[model samples]
Target: MDTILGVSKLSSKFQVTIPKDVREILKVSPGDRIVFIHEEGKIIIKKA
Candidate 1:
């Protein structure tokens, strides 16, 4: 099943805070690193 856990708006500084649900899904912490990839006309985000 495809679920939309969360969404965030881009800020003026081009930063978006990860939503709690999304953070939990990614299992990311404050100092954790994440990777953003642009593939197939979409942005893929994952924990690095």
Candidate 2:
């Protein structure tokens, strides 16, 4: 696994807001598409 850059609390709706540091690392903004990958027991998120 990579280094932990940020953290967020999951909401009751099963949703979590991405942290600002992570957003910066992903270079993403509002309306940007995000890709979710399931691998090795981890959920990987990336900008699409």
Candidate 3:
């Protein structure tokens, strides 16, 4: 598996942009949906 690294910054509207490397590793393209899960105080992003 490939590891992508990038810092996350929150916009004024509270929206975040996923790092390009991470998106590519996950093979995510435009219009694809993702799921955000919270467990034990950790957030996980997964393809939907």
Q: Which candidate achieves the best lDDT against the true structure?
A: 1
Q: How many pairs collide in each candidate, listed in order?
A: 0, 0, 0
TM-score per candidate, in order?
A: 0.80, 0.81, 0.77
**Who wins the TM-score comparison?**
2
Runs of candidate 1 with Cα error greater than 4 angstroms are none
lDDT of 3 at 16: 88
RMSD after CA superposition, every candidate: 1.6, 1.4, 3.0
lDDT of each: 0.91, 0.90, 0.86
lDDT of 3 by residue, 1-48 (tens): 845488889999998888998898778988999999998897888989
Query: Which has the better lDDT: candidate 1, or candidate 3?
Result: 1
**Model 2 segments more than 4 A misplaced:** none
lDDT of 2: 0.90
lDDT of 2 by residue, 1-48 (tens): 678877888899998899889999999999999999999999989898
